[model samples]
Target: MAAVELHVDNRLLDDFEAIRPKLNGHEIGRRSSPVSDDVTVLTMEMVTAPSHARTMEVTLRRVDDQLRVGEIHYWDEHGIFIVPEVPFREVAG
Candidate 1:
């Protein structure tokens, strides 16, 4: 797959960091990188409970001059920290 060519700002990282503490689940493995054609993916394995584990993928696409978060997929449940069908704008440098 062709990797997405988008620049992600540090503030989003900061936002993620800030949001982590408030999350109910603890992240196991996390990855954020370009996937295909103007789409970047954020994947994370989360342990919501002692034995409940789920992996989620969040796809972000470039729209006009902004990068907006797109679809999200998970194992069985809706992904964490995401509003359905809502877009997240990339933080400006």
Candidate 2:
């Protein structure tokens, strides 16, 4: 799959980079897969200290020059599913 261009102004892009160190070394749990002609899904697995792991799924949609993050999901050892909280939307961007 082709690499998608991300905008420097995107909030999620910054958030992901900012947390990179805390994650230790991240893993690409799933490669980018096409969900539609304009959208693709990618999953990253992160390991927290001591032994906990978190899987984050990010759905990207092509919008002009940027691959906008349309959805996000987080899962951990407790079987708890968490998502980024947005004020007015059901999905995280």
Candidate 3:
């Protein structure tokens, strides 16, 4: 995981709907994996018209019975981009 930050342009956010995360290509809710002991990797996909799509690989780690985001990797027309932890943040005043 590299120290990186990404901000989605307003145009892309307005064009695509980001759906739920998918584990092993299946949509999941709340808990990611049936086996809690294993590290879970989920893919979140957003798509828009004209064959444009973005896929984000989210890595989760178990922490005292709770799952926490570990690393994130995003894929788009520009290729893969990685962030060490949480990728998005609200702008400070």
Candidate 4:
């Protein structure tokens, strides 16, 4: 397989960077940076988000031919903060 470009969606990466600051003091549950295959995982320890007051472990991974989301483990935290999907709508905004 001609290695699939891992970063096919740079917009996703850029949006991720914008929220990294809020993840300071996070406890990375898992992380892996592979160089031989198209699969990679980036985990971060999240402490204070835009609307949360607890720590969290976030895992971002890409493999096979699709993207997936993992459950956010937060104790007493409201929930995860995520950017809206980039799906093309039938009507233009």
TM-score of each: 0.31, 0.31, 0.30, 0.26
Which regions of candidate 2 fall more than 4 Å away from where they truly are?
1-53, 83-93
Each candidate's lDDT (Cα)?
0.41, 0.42, 0.37, 0.39
Of the two candidates 2 and 4, the one with more favorable TM-score, higher being better, is 2
Candidate 1 C-alpha lDDT tens digits along 1-93: 111112234446644554445444444443455443433343333333222224444455656755554644443333343233446899999
RMSD of 3: 14.4
Q: Which 10 consecutive positions of candidate 2 have the poorest summed lDDT?
A: 1-10
Ranking by lDDT: 2, 1, 4, 3
Q: Candidate 1: where are CA atoms >4 Å away?
A: 1-11, 34-93
Which of the numbered candidates is closest to the native, going by highest lDDT? 2
Residue-wise lDDT of candidate 4 within 1-93, one digit each (tens)?
Answer: 011112213335554564445444432443333542333344443333323324333455555744444433343234444442356869878
Model 2: lDDT of residue 62 = 59
Model with the higher lDDT, candidate 3 or 4: 4
How many backbone collisions does model 2 have? 0
Give the Cα-based TM-score of candidate 2 against the true structure.
0.31
The residue-level lDDT of candidate 4 at 72 comes to 39
1-93, model 3: which lDDT tens digit per residue? 211223333343322223223222332222234444343323332231113324454455667865555654555456644332446888999
Error of 3 at 21 (Å): 12
